[model samples]
Target: MPAEERGKGPIVTSTYRVQLTPEFGFGELSELTGYLRRLGVGGLYLSPTLQAVAGSQHGYDVTDHSRVRAEFGGVDGLRKLAGQGFRIVADIVPNHMTVPVPESGNAQLWSVLRLGPESPYAAWFDLTFPVALPVLGENPEFTVDGDVLRYWDHEFPLRPGTSALPLDELLEAQHYRLVPWTEPPGYRRFFDVSSLIGIRVEDNEVFEATHRVTLDLIDEGVIDGLRVDHPDGLADPRGYLRRLRAFTDVPVWVEKIVIGHERLPADWPCEGTTGYEALNAITRLFVDPAGADKLIQTFTQRTGVSADYGAVRYEAKKHVLSLFFKGEVDRLESALGEPGLHDAVVEMLAAMPVYRAYVNPGEPPSAEAVRIVETAAAEAGRRTDPGAVARVAHQVLYGPAEAVTRFQQTCGPVMAKGVEDTALYRWFPLACLNEVGGEPDHFAVTPEEFHAFCAVMTPTTMTTLSTHDTKRSEDVRARLAVLSELPDVWADAVESWSGQVRFDPALDYLAWQSLMAAWPIDVDRFTNYLLKAAREAKTSISWIKPDPVYEAGLRDFCRKAVEVCGFSVASFTAVVDRYARVNSLGQKVVQLLMPGIPDIYQGNETTDFSLVDPDNRRPVDYAFRRALLDNPDDDTWDGQKLQTVTACLRVRTRFSADEPYFPIEAGRNAIAFARGDKAVAVATRLPAALERRGGFGGDTVMLPPGRWRCLLTGAEHTGRVPLAHLLSRFPVAVLEGS
Candidate 1:
């Protein structure tokens, strides 16, 4: 087998991502392998399959890593898949584990609790010694009610053997100090999730202990490679990557989110990131940059809010610190021991562009990290105290390494909650541009920029359009991108709709627009999305203190909004579908044939118009997709999308890693590129613009001198053919050298 086929280089064939749960575990996956193979998928990229918090749908909150969860069909199922010749890329959460209750199945964590510092597993977790960890109420008040220790509404049940022990004695025996769930935990956690405690994986013993099962899988040939989840949360991301590389020669990709112009650390020994940047890039290519100003105007007119994402993000981050993470801020303030430092620290964290800087223990912080902090501090200093700003910046830039590490750890959750969770929903400048790690302010990615990014990272990057974590599905976002092209029509339609019904105008604008994109959308899905969106926005109702009145009002408004907007939804979907048909096929062809390795999210090959989590992670209809693949005559949009994806993947397998990439200039309405002599991809980026130009306006795409045939339709074309002729059969074209 070639190195690429062995998961050493780019995953030349595509990877299909599956969200595994008890509801849809290894048995279902095992059953789907032949279908996946038929669809040309090279590997199965699975969600965390380890034993987790009981009944958790997403497996990130792992309770134990020693073995697969029984609910997921365990070792037998894994071997079955491996026996069938499917490559497996497993997601590993090295940063944290589920904080197990005493009776839970996690032996290591339970052992630490029972044996204190003397436990062999004591070094596995990060804990503050001799301090009572806050696990319940603000005050250390607990009542032993039989086997359960109750604090307010919370309960920590003792194990069967420990039921006879007194509550104080039980508490004293634990290595960790449990306190009320507060911010800036005495012990580190995975963001604000108290139940998922951070581990000391940087410790060699801990690394060996936690990764034993996974390494065994790799050695046994059941697992081909690893996907590192949230390496930014670790104390040393670089060190961890080095350690991960040492254990296996199999390919590894980190779940790192690189912000605007932020490059991945060249030194980290991994394949590349899990492709949010690529997702953002491909999605934005289809958006019309010409409509940015008009959409901004329409957004402000309809919603009465500024398109200033930075300001909104800053305020939202501040809200997170004050409202949700008070304990964390308190911890930072205590660490600093200086007046007015908390405010400055929050400002600096809010301004951080990337997730966290990997500052080695002995070295000064990287120039990039220092620049980000100093710049944020300087900007904040103009409004606050210079002395305070300097002190905070100094502490971050030149302080003890652990303090910096703590702040870096704190930044991850703040960004995830405040930016991705809150501000993304609140700021609806253009919902297409609103994605995790996306900069809404950046607007669009030019061909030059997209190609440059590919040049640097394509060989190892995991290119994707949608994932389980995306805010919206690719097709939904594709429809929303239509609004950017037809701002006048969108604004007029929204204005007319707003006059018919009354709700939160900001949310109304958001809901109505999204509803149009996801039309043929049902009431239950719409209602669930609105509730989650409202809570995430934290405007009228929040997760902490939900306003029942406002929620009822929002719910009623959504039902009526759907009723009122039916005609508009029909009309918008008609127009948007035309554009989406082109965009969906375009993105599929481009992503699969682009420079990087492409990953197909389950069901996304069809029309996956899901909204967000729970919705996005729903079960895939393999029978439907399989039937579509089996019979290629149905020309529906879903069938067309699957056909386009399969065709591109087929052509992609012929590509060699040695091929030099050449960007083809195909005018403003399209983006085209070539791989050596044998393969080329051309996708329509702005169909609306093409309509305005009456089709391609004599724009010519340079081919490699001779005849090439479309891989999907077998339409042949010669050198410098008119754009219209090249894309006459399909909106996107993937051609092979004849």
Candidate 2:
């Protein structure tokens, strides 16, 4: 496809990552396509469609790369859905594959095991010790001539005649031996995720096979683009991407997490990342940095630790390194071909700069930073040999800074040390903060940031808000904006309710924090989602151990608090009325205004009240969304949100038909740009507090002489009316020349 074709119109996309079961059918996808078309979405960006292990919800664990998953209705269904005119972008996993064992079926398990390095598939995987890698940390009593690997299959049985054992007793054996690779069978492999054996995609044969599957799909017109998952995991990302691009015309986007201003290699054939950095920029712009600082200090004081940001940062880095690099060090040592060079390389890289040096205008980190890392490595070398130290350092430094930043942010609450530490710290805060970088503060896409983003965000790039992995649904985040302005209201309610209920103040704080963070609003169908999440979290003592007996008491407390604080059921109803008005208007504005192709995850146009991961991945309600799409005049809030989104999309498409190029000038909380003077899209992203503070004052916007009307409210204001009144509704003005 031509590059301009991808960017010629507004993009509306959605993510589908849940397991494909018989319950979800071709009819559902057909209905979904029509709904999306009505919502003005340009395409459907699906998660991996390749067959995955049984019951895998997020289909990243591919077990068969060549076949479409039957549960999702296979190729015919996909083609039928694609015929609806929605572009299809498939998420592909090229870095690794799920290793199948005897229980999974084929008898090639034993053949591959006994053949060792002689097996035809030996070069397909990145195996460590081909000769003796133990499958389950066991030393088999008998050594076979060929490579031997073991699997923990509870189904295999020993013959009674040979072993004098009952079938059930034999089946109880913990490990079954067989080899998948010929290398030393006893040594462990990298990625530490044994079930997901890594592939050497840099190998010509392996690369060809992986590319063939994707190429075939593109050839069949079932897929328009590709999203590469975990690019950093590959040995040569640039090489892999280049080769993949060579075979197909489809646009490719790598899932790179940007930190600071680091850029992807300009030479690579892919466009840009999944936009974690953009998400971060949006959140940070809105979040009060001073509030963040206060929370950090208060957390430290309460914990009574002599800790700075760096210390917490280091600890979080350590945790991620442990998970991702536990076994990869030995592999690095062998590759470097020197006893101490691995450690040296690690120290040098860490000190060089956490970000890609080439992308930054500032010279890499100061020499002092390098010197400091060297010093630390030297000391570490003394305790654990230099080679070992370097190995550890390499793993730590190579991991993305975005991951490190996330770790640092989470460590604050983790260090607070609550019951069910696992539940409190695992994914909640990380998901909440994932969108922070996209906010205006940290990564404003200011004229400066915009220039940078524009330079990077090409046609192949994917822009989104609610993915399967996001902590909160997009609608949830949208509603939470209301709370950002009412922190005192939340704080006061929690305080009074905590006192009345006699719950631990700290625990009460955390509970309220989660509630505020979750932010269930009446407008976007999120209140029910919030209630569901609360109930789900309550099931596991891990998230909150609010005395079991007090579960009802706590819920009642919440009910009363929300009511007494004027956020009661009746108040919530009132808020819903306002939300209906705002959400419809806002959805239309976003659908019409954003420059990049907009992505709408399944069911989001009507109401998306999901939480992160599994919650977001729940089977989309195509029936409901289809009903809304079919009924253009359904007098409901969700229907309104959909209608507005559709209207904006139509407007955007019409405006960009002839002349699409334009320049954007920055204003306080607003972006002003002219679309050939046929229309001007002035998007207001005012902070809730600023909006409540009577809005910003200034005639910072200088427009060409003309009469203008706010596209949203249709309130005409000519010749530079007060920018404040013009911005009251967070207007996205599409001014037409009179």
Candidate 3:
């Protein structure tokens, strides 16, 4: 298939991402069709709807692939929603399948356990039997039933002729071994999540079976597009995409993370990434590089953390590998058949700049892949054995097939766990800059760089500001960006707050930042966020390593901070309130009006002060939003945001994403651009700095000659417009040409 035809699917004008859970499923979504239509969304970008473990909140842990989840109103409810005329962009998990608590919840996995290697479904998953399941506790006891082996409410299938034997003898006869709960499993898993077992989707048979229901939905026109979750986790991402494209050409977007100046491979048969690149790019425009030094210095001074992010990240990766990825390292080390290469392999994996190297078996590695291997090896060599680095690097590119494939697969999860989960929490110079697939050390992007990024965006590629995975919501980051301008004031406030109610010095700075960033948050929300932060940082406590006394102190610290320092934090927020609002509105307008099919993550149409999962996935009070829309109030921030989003979406239809983009020469405080001949987007960047410099002050953006009306405020203009006038009411101005 031609690469141009690879990702082509239904034309999605705009999307509203709905987190589908038992609380909100297809039936619930069906009820919101009228509201969604009014919200200017053309498609429902849904979370995974495949049948997963019963009562699963996020459906990424899919137990079966052949059926739409009955809990999510099943296939009938989905078809009924499709009848509403909105495109359905389904989020699909192709990398792994869930191993539910009952163990029998996934029939194929159960059958495999019962029948061993002779099971017809043996090829479906990547397993190395006797499969080592980590379900045993210390001093574990077992009981036997008619055809099952039981251990404290957990059951396993008994092999034929093994049910009549002694418990110990029966265990020996079984196809799988049970180990202590803390031990890593012997089978391939999605990251360190042993329950979410990795599937061999690279196999054609596996692909057919796994994607059958989704494909059937596509054929039936019930599904219009696909958002492939965690493509980097797949063994042959490029090959898997090619096979998927062969089957159907719906706008297939991979949840691929691209780092600094790295473009998604043009040859890959899919649409671009699900838009961390765009998210970072949008964030960069608002972040002032000038403030990086002050912020870094302030952060270091306050928390005693090193200023170097790369070093901090490298250490974090090494720590994460030792803690969570020892099983993967051991597997690769065993595959290499080379002695004493374990440390070198770990170092290289830790040193990897991107998620993974695209070194598929038989086919030669891409230049990008080779570069990544060489770069990581070079860096790894600095700390470990250079000879080992050379040997491992060679093996990665030209060694055993199993070694090469496993090495590639392992890098992504290692990076994700080490960086996104660990390093991001550890390094806190400017929390706004610390996003997925982004370097916080690299503080900001110039307007020219942002424009260059915007110029090449794929029309149908997804663009978004916030997602379920973001460290903070779009508005939260927007609010935090104001710190770049007022770093001195922020530093003083933290010092004063610390004096009043202090925690661990290493984490106190971050806690204060979070408190102010997500202001109006109560005790429970604030304490829960801090606890997660403490665990993710793995400083004094971690998810695996529980410290009861330390955690209690952490909780008490949060309470004290909120109760004693809440008033002070609120006062500081009030000071930067206007500027933060400007940034919040500005970035929203820019992201929505820019190229690509923008997604409005639930409740982000107004303002969502969320932090990470479960928090970000909190129930959106749509009734409140609906009421606000019913009675529009420009006087309020939420109302202003609603007005901005609706305006951008309204005029977004007039501008073709692939059309010629003309960059308008506005002053440095503002970014201005025209999308084709139809719409012009102008947003205030660095509002605090702009204010410091006596405002727009004769700064003008040359508009196209002819009548143009501001879509946001309904103001009329005929040519060059002053920045102050164009953005009088709001910080962003979207003008539609007459």
Candidate 4:
């Protein structure tokens, strides 16, 4: 709580991620400190706390930056959490603010809407005069009451002296217009969600205004660090980060998603990304790439979807750009000051490998950015007009400021909606690889490659397995990873299950995958997740385009899947259960002990079979977890997982963040790493394959020439120890060297 400790990152090695909602506010969090402390937590990583819309769950739709949300007990609650002696990393959203329906929650947005471009707050938003609000449905009606315009539970401010104007005249007289939801406007937005309008953090006054309270909190030492939300959405990511670092002296990290071999931009002044890149490396290390052919064949033949990741991504990108990104496309085309380049631009965007190019106008693109653009352009040229593509690409890379910024901003959203959301849901050969910024077709990462990734990582960068945004939990992915080693048996089970409970053929394979991975789930949970999956795929249904008949059939099929195929799914799970256990404990220990302050999502220490967002956000039964951690030697998966995670956390706390990683090559089926010289982690990968090879065949790990004690089992050994004995009790062994 001293200002002297502010800039120094968390004093401990690990932080626990908690999704704070109205139900589990600061008071509730204060209650969990005892448990977190027992679990070796050094800091508390929180969800967004700024005042968002009423009853908002995730809190990213921030409405007020000057005040914390009252639903979560506000400024006082935040102060209390900080007082609990946990270094606080407050998640702040400076990129965008919510455009709530009532329009009064955000006073800045309201003032801008009421006063047009003349308002003092106009510079805070990325809107123009006569802001076009795309909110109308068919048969739209509006009424004006004293100083207010009303539209079906939505209220807008009336301009001065326009309360008595005719309905159409009043609509035209206001500083904003209500158009059909189909007609999206040209204001900068967070991806395709028009309601969450982007803000101009490039402006100094706007940055100060939006970040005032948080900065003050940092000065007071109520917040020790910051996790920036979505920096790529900014006009100048470098300038924004530079300005951010200037304002506060604390560790800052961005929610940046880096693709394969694409490192974070070196110029950005931040620690590192929130660790999707590490997530990819950790999950893939458990996968068996040799099984990719069999899995892809099964998926393609059974579901009739393309196994070519590139083609699936291209089609998905093309579909999303046409459906939701027309505004962005039109904006880019206009900025380029060119004609007939829309197709060229869309094709290039679809082919883009990274999220966005950080090319400023008049400045040459960075080498990495150049490589990314060249790769995409080469692919785009094969499909579209090469001349047009070349023209648009040249303009975006080296032309006017508007053209460059517009192109850079458009790339992030298109990649997110197309690849991560749509294509991931559509192409599911191995669901474990279908994560954010993950390649489904590209299967495992060799231990050497994983070490290469860890070698370059900033030590303070956060590392995680399951996060609030991951497609599946660590446990779910662990279960799914087992299928790669048993693809033949999996294919036969799916083929048999397909003959019984028939849903949409496109979704049948995915449903089976999810059901088995997130087993022991209820019918409601299973069906709800499948519905979301169906919508994300955008094949049979979508969030905006619902097919009730199809949904009903899907639900009916879910019931049948439980009634008839449940036994088979259970049988299939039973066969793969031990391997899943190996993966569950292996990945958990690796994440906890690996480089970069390891972070654990709430309830992940034991077992979490959750799917995406709402499911992931479900409350942690901490009392149960506390009891389990109290007696972690009960010979169950939860007990073993908790022990392994706890052991790694305790060992990790002893080491400083600056400690280097030394990879210890164990064998073909194991990954071993020594952090500095005192701690070493060894985890089993592809346990089914290891079993096929008959238990390591005398594989051994050379310890760092000292008597080492296993943190999990308390077994001590010297020199080279056979993994068969070192990891006899569990799939993972955490050793502390003398």
Candidate 5:
């Protein structure tokens, strides 16, 4: 294919969690290959496929770099599937590898652990002490050795005898039984996660070993591209990426988290980041900041917490520092050679002009930022070692600022207001909270803005709507947009039921209920599981265990609330019915019409209302997808919806054959674009709450003279019709000019 042909239409791709065998079977790759081609997807963007710890659902904790995972049909299956014409984009983790314990039976990892810092593989891992030391959390009496650590196989320990001694005791042990370190006295590791020992991939040898398998796949034409995970964790990402680029001409994209105004390194040879910024921008555009503020105030008043947003933000920072930073600080202290060097580093970091917590590259500071650190040092009542204080301060300021900001944005309201009578708070931060400070106006990409972004994109760049990490599924977000228009109705419903339920962490509990109604999940056993999760999160914040009395009351309240809200036992059933039709249609619209390559997450072309992480990585029902694709005319609603989306996908593939490019025109609450004289696409983002405006061209972009006919509804209009009327039946239109 010509280079221009590759860049022409939106590239449709799907993300498959390698661990979810049911979602994308290694054995069924042949079947999946045919389906992907039929669906017109140009590529498959798979999650990490390297051998991971057993039962590892998301596959980030890779155990080996050389081989494909047996759970995902291994090397043979992958190559066979790649032969089917869909480009393969493999996700690779270079920063770290899973620490192998005894039970894993991996002699190589065990050898590294046993040999400690002196082993040939020592350079592959980042460790602080020359001797392997046990990591301590809350419990302080346990110990972990090479043999013992390897013995412990489960996620959470069950019995002391079943694994190594407890973690604390391992730290206190005088002599180590595990791997001994080769480094002098002090060494450093990444973040405090011992199990996830960082690698020195910047080393030429380490880089070759890590890239060998991937490069071989590329050579065989089995893998078409790469997504480098955690680029920030590496010491020299720019150099590492450039080196990788030297090996292959395949497209490479870095998974870099964009914190505020941070731009990608100009030297890195990659297309673009996986679209988190785009997601953040699009989501913030519709969230009601005033409403969020009101919720915060209401919660604060109810809880008697005097801390404002900034204060709460500080507290969250302190919490993370206490939990995850001490080890990193110790490592940095050792590296600097000076006594109290950690504090000095922190002081300099706090005083630095720019915040680059993870990767600091600059000169030693003047005294101004030091003065601020000194004040903090004095307040702690100890003669704060200036160096130590500075280091700690730097950790606080730079280390987890983005995560802290995200948590503050999401949980500020919950922390401010105590949960109703239960006096509990929401744990971590809920997704709803993060939507604040993300006002659409803050980063919304209008047509002009999108054009600016597009101007920067080479034909090799990737574009997407949903990914494995997105807070809400794209279809869910589209439906949630309806709420922006009908906030009053939702508010009224909440008000009516406010007095009936006695939920601990009241606001969060109520919020969960509302979320349940808004995005109805399976009401069978699945509903019970979700309800249990809600209760668990509530109790964690409340510092209380589940109570029978409260559980009964909650059940009763839910029943009454449903009754009052005119919902039936069939409410969830009704929701699923409508959601199936609407969301499926919405997916088809986005997949086909959106500019750039449209990437579909594993199973997202159907209904996937999964929450973040583990939830989103659940087993895919490939059988269902296969059956739906095979029987496009099935009578069932979900099957019908699937057929509809598939049909539209087929049309998009056919239309894209001619290689059409569209230029957009803005409307009051709508957007109009033309694809030559053959077709024009019009889309409305009408929030139900916004007043219905005079039509597409009132004060919006004036439409050019032409007779246009709506493709879906066949309505004809000379010049421009009232957008409100045009959009009453359809949120989007693709008009074929007569």
Candidate 6:
């Protein structure tokens, strides 16, 4: 397996995370190749390109596995991109498939519905026997038409002839049992999503069926690598990876969430994680740890929320289980064979430090994971059902693979829904620290930790600052990091503006902070993001049943936030702009020069201040970016952002995987490191601290003790110098051996 032949090579991947809908499909993406190439991108890491549920913006809800998305120009478009010599890394959803209402497009699911247990495809999905797929309200009396099964307002298309039977008989004849959407049915699904059913990809037949097109694309040279989405949801991720590796020898990266201090399982066959850990490490290094108390104070005063992240996480998990995943909890309890053990299980899951432990049957569970479970159970104050605990321990440690698999799958979604989606919006400590797989409680990443992480994991890691699912863009986060510098100014702005408008205290605090970070925001983007943010917080309103009165209040607040507070907005923007420039260039330099295959999210070359989802996925203005790239004299902050990225990436191409990484002894206000003897990245971490300390008056950063040319300014420097001299030209200095 030569590096290129095995799809394992040094890559500077650019992530195209938006879906290929009719408006922006393959044709649209194909136009960016030359621009990407010129930007120094080595490959395109694409979103799920397979067929998905109709009109899905992000292709995670894949409905078909055997072909490329029809709207995205299918295989030909992929070949076209690859034909241009750009390596393609495709995202594959092996854990689940969409279960649309009509059941018309999915042949296998429809067959199972029509033929019950006798259908050959019945074994493909993770359904308990005498199968019941919940499609209608609980115990509803239904009427039937020619081919429609009607339950109240909903009419579902059953198999043509089966509709002729009474609704009850028709339901009984189907392999899946249709229950209310609210019911946590026995079947495994992707998280608590009722419409996305989990596939038994651990089954040899299922794996083959689901991965047919993916394997073909690899064989045909259209795709050079694989990114396995939500491997935590799979029954046997390790086994599946092994099978996938055997099936195709291409490099693979799992979308595995490694929490604080946890590493990816050593035994799994893959390149590395999709890089949330690295994202956490790099981003938090830029955040000021001293601001944690003030932010928590503001959060507490307004929202009346506690500062304890763990308690909030535990309660949020409980809330999700009770309100949303009641049936799933019930099922897990049943599997444990003890009714009282429900809370205990939920407690253990909520306390799980990492996404999951890689424990195989007949093998011991990781001691650390065992300790986490035991501690959570004790702290939950529920007397352990010894027998039930033993049963669960057996499943987690030994056989009954399905039980353990479901348990593992359950932990990730609970953590995601409880923490990232819910608690992150609630906690206003720092929006940047509340990223995916990041711990808000842990305010900063120490230099020692960052160095150690890069030493071992950087070789195969996929480091990124922004991604499609990020709560905020990298630059947006960069701007927000500046808020830590002037906590008093930030607190004053929040207090003064918040006095004029009435909104949910906590939500308002969060909104104002976010608005400051992305100041001069438009009405539409602000309103939409606020609405989504409020719903995700779920304190006052929710996604399923939004509170109209609360939503109206939010809209008013958003309007006032932009229209009424011009002075405060101007003041904050000025401060943010100054610090944002430093943060932006520093991050760009470090990310590109860091010890990993760095990925630049589209449109992030400039100072992107976009928020999560639809906001982050908005169409890129390539023309504007290209114009900036072409105009060397354009000294705007966006140009600086682009220049820093370009210079480091070009310098990066010269370094090999075996390049030596030495951490530099830059002062506390800055971080500098050398990549071998050639590349030195000196990034300013705390601009506020430096300004207070009188601009590195006596501080010095020892160079490689030889002549080095500044990559950005082309200035020459030798040996030690006032750190001010090194960073006077740019907030960050990227230098190479002269």
Estimate the TM-score of every prediction. 0.94, 0.71, 0.98, 0.98, 0.71, 0.94
lDDT of each: 0.79, 0.49, 0.87, 0.88, 0.49, 0.77
lDDT of 6 by residue, 1-738 (tens): 224546545443434343456567777888877877777777778889999877878888787888899888888887887788788888899988987756666777777666656779888887775555566654578777776666665455565467667656877765456766556666778877877888989889989988999899888988988889999888778889999989888778888888877888778888787877888888888888788788778778877889897778777777776666766666666766545777567666666666777665556777875775555545544545555555555555454655666677777778778887887887767778889998887877666667776778646567788888889888888888887777777888778888877577778777877787776688789999999998888888877667788888788888887888756777878877888789888877877777767778888888898898898888888899989889755778998888888887778777764478888888788888888887898988878877887788888888986788887888998899678888887888989986
Q: State the lDDT at 165 in candidate 5.
A: 46
> Which scores higher on lDDT, 3 or 4?
4
| Tens-digit lDDT track of model 4 for 1-738 | 212256464444777888888888999999899888888887899999889888988999999998988999999989998899989888988789899978877899888888887889989877667888898999998887798888997889998888898898889899998888877665889988888999999999999999999999989989888889999999999899899878887888789998888888888887778888888999999999888899999999988997788888889999999988887888889989988998999999899988898998778788877877878889999998999988987888888899999889989999999998899999999998999989888799889998998889878788899889999999999999999999998999998998988878789999999999998888999999999999999998997789889999999999899889898888888888889999999888778777787889989988899998888999888888899988867789888888888888888888887688999989889999988877999999999999998998789999987788998888998889999999888888999987
Which residue pairs come into collision in candidate 4?
none
Write model 1 residue lDDT over 245-279, tens digit each, in one string: 78888888889998887878888887788889888
Mark the regions of model 5 whose C-alpha exceeds 4 Å error after superposition. 1-24, 100-106, 130-194, 285-311, 336-460, 506-514, 522-595, 622-663, 672-681, 690-729, 734-738
Judge candidate 1 at residue 163 and give its lDDT: 58
Candidate 3 has its poorest 10 consecutive residues by lDDT at 1-10
**Candidate whose lDDT is highest:** 4
Model 1 stretches with alpha carbons more than 4 Å out: 1-12, 100-105, 129-185, 335-340
lDDT of 6: 0.77
Candidate 1 scores a C-alpha RMSD against the true structure in Å of 2.9
Clashes of each: 11, 45, 0, 0, 40, 8
Error of 4 at 289 (Å): 1.6
TM-score for candidate 2, residues paired by index: 0.71
Compared with the true structure, what per-residue lDDT tens digits does model 2 show for residues 589-699?
533444445555666666575665556766776677767778877766677666656655555555442334354554545555555656665555534544565566664
> Where does model 6 exceed 4 Å of error?
1-19, 129-162, 381-395
What lDDT score is found at residue 322 in candidate 4? 90
